[model samples]
Target: MHSRKPFYLLVALLFISGLAASIYRGIEHNVPFLPGKQVQSWAVDAKVRFQATGEPAEVSFSLPEDPAYEVLVENATSPGYGLSITSDEEGRRAIWSIRQARGQQDLYYKVTLIPTGVKQILATEEPATPEPYSWPATEQAAAEQAIEEVWSRSATNLSFAQQLNKALTASERSQNIELLLSSNRPAQLFVRMLNSKGIPAQAVSGLFLEDQRRRQQLVTFVEVYHDGQWHLFNPVDGSQGRPDNLLIWDRSGKSTLDVIGGINSQVNFSMLQDTRSALATSIDVMMNNDALDFSLYQLPLEEQSLFKGILLIPIGVLMVVFLRVIIGIKTSGTFMPVLIALAFIQTTLLTGLIGFLLIVAFGLTIRSYLSKLNLLLISRISAVIIVVIGIIGLFTLLSYKFGLSEGLTITFFPMIILAWTIERMSILWEEEGAKEVFVQGGGSLFVATLAYLAMSASWVQHWVFNFLGIHLVILAMVLLMGQYTGYKLLELRRFKPLAGE
Candidate 1:
């Protein structure tokens, strides 16, 4: 006479938590609710070519830095050189050094990146301090005059940058603008002027992504620190905000490539865009987001594949519960069908069914003979276990001899479960008569087949493996069903005569 309120409340809480967690994972991690969803990715290849001096050579190249995108993979092709990745205040760089080199040396670095749909504002704990500027008197005068003019025409830091960029690229520019452009790059001068006015700014390089493009080089952009976050602006046209296809390559205001012992060194990029399954991208996102600590994906690939099959057990168990509790279907051993369904996953439906029937039938014949010995219960079960193993081996050998390769999978069946099943059936036959044995045996087979169908489904496998919350939901459903006290569907047939009355 326990209160059912607590039971119902527990079920509701479990269901809600499971459903909410699954929805959050789908939206937050970009995991597709369904399989086969596609996500865009880009692969960029950088080729560095230079003439060697027959001496020890060293080359350094900058790596991409974009908070809006996640790097999926990266590697370098340096046959004779030692490659290593190093990071510093400047940023991450790939350095390749060789003991001795002569003539033309070619090096290649490649990377694949996927958009994360994250905002690209750069935030720092403390406001950046501007670097000291010491140019020649004429250049200093020019920079100061240009800054004054832009300051007079602008209010905010962003507006001042826009005005200065416009003046630098004007159709008819002023004398100071011409002087600044003669000796300095546009983006570099723009940043310097912004910094001289006590606004922190830096010149960064970005690549405008285009499909199937080759021999591409990085373009410079100015990043001005305003309102506590760095905002990107195209110094060429003063267009503000980061572009959807722009990948920030270098933000350290340093050289992208530096060769210590080579001449005429250059790096050119080739890029291609493609699409992949959203599931694959989700793994990358999880790895980048440090979600692997709680994810099955963190397991080695072999273990992950093993769990994929193991995680389907609950689906089979759920099917068994529904069939037995709601429909009053009698099964030999409450969950033996679930294990049999697991075997079916390995051996496939037809082969597993045939193998199961052959082994059980052969074992039952031997089990009947053992019943005459009047052995102890434990000893009787042990004898059946050994007999079940023998039956499995004999059937497997026969299948192989007959060239039925599918029978090899019979080894995957749980031998102890089969032995216990045979023992139970033999006891049931002796006590309940042969007709009752067939009824329960057929029901077991029916339930196992249905469980196999449910567990082997593609969508079911995807959801169970990708989202652990599904197991919780299944647990809730099973618990709720356990409390049922209503009439079974099969039992209702006994009242058919009353309908006519």
Candidate 2:
């Protein structure tokens, strides 16, 4: 039955674990705070009304040129109101009017706009487009001419041109012209050329799908205001400066184009001005809300005050397991050393270790001298405790005198543990000699240092805090330590002669 205790404990834990999982899933999936699917788009209704004193009020309504599929004006009821559809210098407008209300009369008009297309328009601006020009027939002559023209251009006006001239000249002279032209950097040179010629041009960063492979294309599109309309120009492919196969933006509307630069290629282009989807935003908010709710429930009230202290337990346990199972370090009690180490974490390891050692050493020294008095073990321990306290007081006073308040505070040093260690060390010193006592005391301090390091590690703290499920990590460590059947390092050293066979 004693041997079956662990099995029953494990079974009970498993049942509780399954229960917790089911509860979590139920809450996370069913609750509004938890993340589910995203809401894709929003339906908006906008209405505008106008009233004039004597004359008929003229009002216009226009919709965004974005290709939203569902847009309608519904329940637009205004008695004795005039409505007209008109085309203006701008694309289109709906005109309506209502007589002035004596007091405050309500007019009802509802216009609904729903997004129809996958791609949304982002921006619109009018750009100057330049005429198409061809490069020299041969690649070599074109490269040379491009370099010369770029270098002769005005420095103030064509900075990009000058830089491109230097780069192209170096590449051509080295016979690496193909490598340079194949890259997207040359698009900047194209932009410089258009800008120098008084055509508004800029380089655009976007992904391009090609027949063989998908590539990132940095193309320069020139916007020219000509013939009372804005046009787009692409000099790289000699596209005759048209907006048809180019994505360009001006003050007017966002435009996107799909182009197939190579022969026998089909390209499709789409644009989205508003990058974020409503569903994605909603899902993010839900996930955050759920996480906060889970945190509020998972943390226990009693442990909340010493939350940081409780967090150090796994690290301390790991150190204890490593010392006992791997290194075979023996201290006074199981887990007592880990608890002591945690106490050390409150006051750093170095200061804690130094203070601990000093107090223990002073108490043990006093204990040995008082052993000549032939007192009982309890009385002897009591006397040692008094001496330890006196030594702590002296140490505190000395620290203050030396302006070391930080160091002195550690002198308080869990007095009970210090007194017990002193008694144990004195016995070991007397019976087992100085070496055994030093080894055990030093081992305890070494274990404490390891625990301190593990507790302080940022990654350990992050994992433990973010995933309270990491208590499973501690359980896993416990299981691994239980199954460790190998000989300890100390045992190997002591039994070295057995290995010689």
Candidate 3:
């Protein structure tokens, strides 16, 4: 006897691998397991305004970067100016240059990103020793005293920096704390103090994102090298780690915007937060990243849409298998219901059903008349196909004349399938009478309707399209159903007398 073990093993493998891939994509790519989950996306617009000096002019604007978000799109708008984007160890920058410019000038930069809600940890290469700041004599004395006091209270570099920030921003500050705050910004002082103690640190600019906010300015945050990575801290509140809504825009410790040969140069930001389909947002994020992902989302829009319908066929096939093997439904032809159900997706349920019934009814009438002509099998089938097309065209014209636009979609049905179906039913009618034809035809329609309902569901479409691995699970199910050799559900009634005996 042949072993069923190999078949079961293959089925288990397919099921497990398909489930794992789907779950992994859902978690790693931020794709929700269900549909309609919304993701927050931010649209930021930066406006750079300055007065041109009627000579050559150039402006460099720093771009935003954060590990918590993935940028989907970035663009710049500057008329009559050459724009060049450059990326380096520092970060990305947009440079706009123009010759013989005059009067006021405005350059705009726009970007869209979906936040991943992951915290940012600043990382950099080994840093060179920082140069000592040239502080005034009294201020210098205060600095040393403040650093020594904060150092005594803390052990590690992160703790030391946090304590220094706490001391600088305290409400009731000491004499040295007051001296330090009077001369420098809290973030700058925090970094200088950390550097003075031989720790690597820098003052970076972070933007606090708010919905529908205009004229937004960058806030200073201190970054200190600790435990092999740089950590961000709020100098004002001594809070460690990055804020969820705060975007680190400038980390180079340089000016965020620089305009040469222009006066009163400044940059202003406006941002709006919106929600979008989580799946679409996740797909966009994956496309933007360098990670290896296998998904239909990578296909072109047209092909992706086609695949959306194609992928649904397996679902209809599964329904057909269950109905035929387990329920003992007698379809006119195997797999025909799946094609009909797919057509129903385009033409919709009620309209497709009505259209299918009318086309087959008319085609069978014409086919019955042609069957008496002694035509060859191929010629008869080909003639039936032509007759089906004519019947559909006639129905469409009639539908349009009567203002029934849905009937126009009847053409979406496969003409060849309809032809073959009509020919089979006609032949069945001649051999076994009309009752068997109706039984098979009705069964096919019943199966197709059920399949259509399953395949057309929003959640079903979302899963099948987003997760191709699911088809394997469906295939395994169909294969397992193929192994069923017991009496069909409809055949059980014939054994009722035997059971009673």
Candidate 4:
């Protein structure tokens, strides 16, 4: 054992070196092997600049809404300001409150947006019917007459709104409609006139998120409710639908920002497009640490799925090595315990244990009777195979009939291997007596259980799958175990009589 230590140490060194190199390559490539979801994400970084006075300062900015898109996470940097986000009956807003300050101050807020792929237009708590606008007397009659003319030409609510929308914003509009635009914004004016005619309508501001845009202005649209749904129409061209990338902003029709004690307080946006594992990204952001960033970040999702389970097998093998070589667990076969452990993972611990015990106990009874026929070794195993399968079938039917779905997973156990295990235990009982047979059989289950626990662990599964070096580390540990020449833990117990002497 002493002489072989050098060889084992070298093997361990090589495994470590190989693992390091693989991890390095994985890191360079950004093929994430980590156990989590891979999500395509967008980082919308917004900067708000203002010059603060030496008094209390408060800044409020309206936030985005849902059913259009979702804010997955958000963070802000305000060197001297205290930031707080609040939501009310009106809408959600971020408020930065400061006690006192002087000179130019820059406050930054970053929002990560994820497309939900499902749209739902949220209902505001406004009256079931829209309230008519209060306009100056001269404009009121002209707006009402113009809206009446459009409403008369159109039949459906949507069509009336569309026709009205066009007449108000058309480049060569009629005298009444063009005068309305000159004094008021087309979208808002059209909505008020619409309400005057008893149709529920409102103007909304939104952002069309396409490319990196700075100091972007909100695009307004007129929305009319009919048939239990809100329909958006472009105020400029009377277009019927919103852009696929539209983000509804300032929906409550509130001012985007309210600032006191700050001059020229304005927001600028800088956006970057990147993809990350959605499940892992939040954790990564929360940790504020990137020490574990590896190349296995964005490999094909299917390949990542394959490696996750595959990598855990080595850890199971290491468990088997330590149990058999160092602890002297007398399993029926070498390396078979690892496969059993894998099956246990699918079936779960308690159910698998119960199923395994039931099958083996029943198999042993059949094996004893088979021995009476005086058959050859191959014939015996083949006969046991048929019987073991029959046993599995019977158990599955009974379990299913009784509604124990977990027992159905018993099929994942290697049927052939179970047959062999029954045969080995039977033969071992005949040769070494019943006590030894029970000891070895129970030991196999014991070691396999330990292996399952190690492989099924969350962190172990993550490390092995993500870092190709983890298998190397497992190999190194197994090699180190191989150099253990001292008495097995069980062997040491056997020396109790010698010590008693």
Candidate 1: stretches off by over 4 Å: 1-13, 16-38, 53-57, 79-82, 98-103, 129-155, 163-183, 274-291, 294-305, 362-383, 433-435, 494-501
For model 4, how big is the CA root-mean-square deviation? 22.1
Query: Over the stretch 47-94, how does candidate 1's per-residue lDDT look in tens digits?
Result: 999999999999999998788878888999999899999988778999
| lDDT score at residue 310, model 1, on the 0-100 scale | 90
**Regions of model 3 farther than 4 Å from truth:** 122-136, 290-301, 371-375, 495-501
lDDT of the candidates, in the order given: 0.90, 0.54, 0.89, 0.78
lDDT of 4 by residue, 118-226 (tens): 5757465444776667879879788778877998899998788888877766778888887788888777787887888778887777876756666766788777887
TM-score, one value per model: 0.84, 0.45, 0.91, 0.53
Q: TM-score order of candidates, best first? A: 3, 1, 4, 2
State candidate 2's TM-score: 0.45
Q: Which candidate comes out best when scored by TM-score?
A: 3
**Angstrom error at residue 458, model 1:** 2.6
Order of the predicted models by lDDT, top scorer first: 1, 3, 4, 2
RMSD of each: 3.7, 19.3, 2.7, 22.1
Off by over 4 Å in 2: 1-305, 483-486
| Poorest lDDT segment (10 consecutive residues) of candidate 1 | 119-128
